[model samples]
Target: MRRKKQIFLSLGIAIVLLAVTWWVDLWRNTEATIQVLAARCDIPAGSRIEADHLALISIPASLNRAGYLENQELAIGRWTTGFLAEGEFITTNRLHDRARGLSYPDAALGRRLITLKLEPAAANGFWLAAGNHIDLFLIPHSQDRESEMLILEQIRIMAVLDENTGHRLTDTHLATTTGRLICLDLNVEQAGLILGRLGSHDIRMAVVNENPTG
Candidate 1:
């Protein structure tokens, strides 16, 4: 009877060892995963990151590294420092914080912000909004005897404002605001070109493209 009891104890010990081995192997083979934020679609450089532009994805924890954003709130309302491909992980270095409330865009750093006050009729009937690309035409004061010239093509609209209230309008607010003022993002040369012609020429704008890729 003692021999039978010892045999049963040995069998129990063997089963316990087997179960531990199996669990260790399973743990070793299963990869740990972590969630990170990624671009839901191709995001252009200098474009604002909206809620729809982000997605949460699970990846092997081994692949997770510092600077990767884990929260959506951290990305929304921020602007991209450079273009991000779809499914690419969002990192801290790739985003520019908008909370600084700078009068100019970080993406337009080293560039000039030029504001143009348009007549109610010249404001594209108030159809233009921020992020739209426009072409500017110059009517050369009729003194140069030159035909109307295309001064700028594909210039990005930085902001639309209600000239009367001096309030900036974007998205839904754009519909309610009378956008008679527009701010343009231009390089030094482009700003100079527009500034040189401003007083002498009657400038008109046309929306050539909307939300153009970087």
Candidate 2:
């Protein structure tokens, strides 16, 4: 009976030890380092990232397990969707398609989304999207002036519209391709300035944030 008791105790101890080892191994695996691509320099939003600007690094997988760039090819030929400091791991949300562009949230800090309708020649061939910084050029359609004047600069495009069809592109879809009006996000004072210039000056949308490489 004593031998039987000893055997049962040994079995219980072994089971406990096995369970403890499994837990430790699971913890270690979760904390394991994963290979990912990171920016080597300060890559600004809208800049086309290349291999020279990237480096493969091993990092704690669980630290930022979500949205990590898993391959070098994924990093190449993609635009930085937002500002990326040096040595920052490239994530899915941090990159964008080269043809398509980035869009931002609703304007904050005492700003409103102001919708402004401009001619096709004025709105940059319908390539406008949210988060695009634009400058409005007022070419005097009247007899007052022969030269072009800068009426508005650094205006943020909050939304776009298909003026003919009246569709609002909130998320920048195929709907924006037919978009004509580039909505501006601005303060009360700024809104007054843009609206006041409409009659005499024909406003044109120039994307100031177009790829610097180009």
Candidate 3:
């Protein structure tokens, strides 16, 4: 009878110790965090990652996983394959290292990619580049002198192309380029609206704030 009592007591002690160890592990995981690279602003597709575009963010160590780039040097110079919102985690699947000729990203489900040729002034004197957000406005051609309407708000520019050669232009070469073009990532409905106004209405672009919240 004494042996049975000792066996039960021993089992109870073992179980209690196991539970305490597990609780300690869980608490440590909850408090431990590591820094990871994240987008500082809205990073549009096809844009090369720069030091200023990234910010270090702290996340729980337990949430860390493979394929997430933790070093800023690893991300710099890599081109983004898709739009990354501010504070979004940078991952290997969304970036490429090769500088091969500009390749348009496949439009995400429920989204559409559209390119439009614009006058240098319409493209903000060719100063705009990928990752910049713009507000699009249209002036109707009606004889009654209709007011300019704001067609789109906070649309992201995906890439800037040379109108004459149809090649992507970098920021350094934009000054020498005569005509400029811009590609936009938009929803199906917004794409249709812009496409329909291509010939009839006078369209213009206004660069908006880089940080939406700021």
Query: Number of backbone collisions per candidate, in order?
Result: 0, 0, 0
List residue ranges in candidate 3 displaced over 4 A.
1-107, 143-148, 172-174, 212-214
Per-residue lDDT over 1-214 for candidate 2, one digit per residue giving the tens place of the 0 to 100 score: 9999999999999999999999999988778787888888998778898889998898777776476886899878888878899988888888877734444457686675678776566677666577788886766777654545756788878777767876776654332345377778877877886677778667776788668676
Task: For candidate 2, list the clashing residue pairs, or say none.
Answer: none
Misplaced by over 4 Å in model 2 are 1-105, 143-148, 164-167, 170-179, 210-214
lDDT (0 to 1) per candidate: 0.80, 0.75, 0.81
Q: Please state the error at residue 113 of candidate 3 in Å.
A: 1.4
Residues 1-214 of candidate 3 have per-residue lDDT tens digits of: 9999999999999999999999999998769788988899999788999999999988877788765678999999999887899999899888988644345554455567889887776767767788788998876776464645647988988788777787876772345547777889898889988888777788888988576577
Q: Give the TM-score of candidate 2.
A: 0.42
**1 or 2: which has the higher TM-score?**
1
In order of appearance, the predictions have TM-scores of 0.46, 0.42, 0.46
Residue 9 local lDDT, model 3: 100
Candidate 1's C-alpha runs over 4 A off are: 1-103, 146-150, 171-179, 211-214
**How does candidate 3 score on lDDT?**
0.81
Instruction: Rank candidates by TM-score, best first.
Output: 3, 1, 2
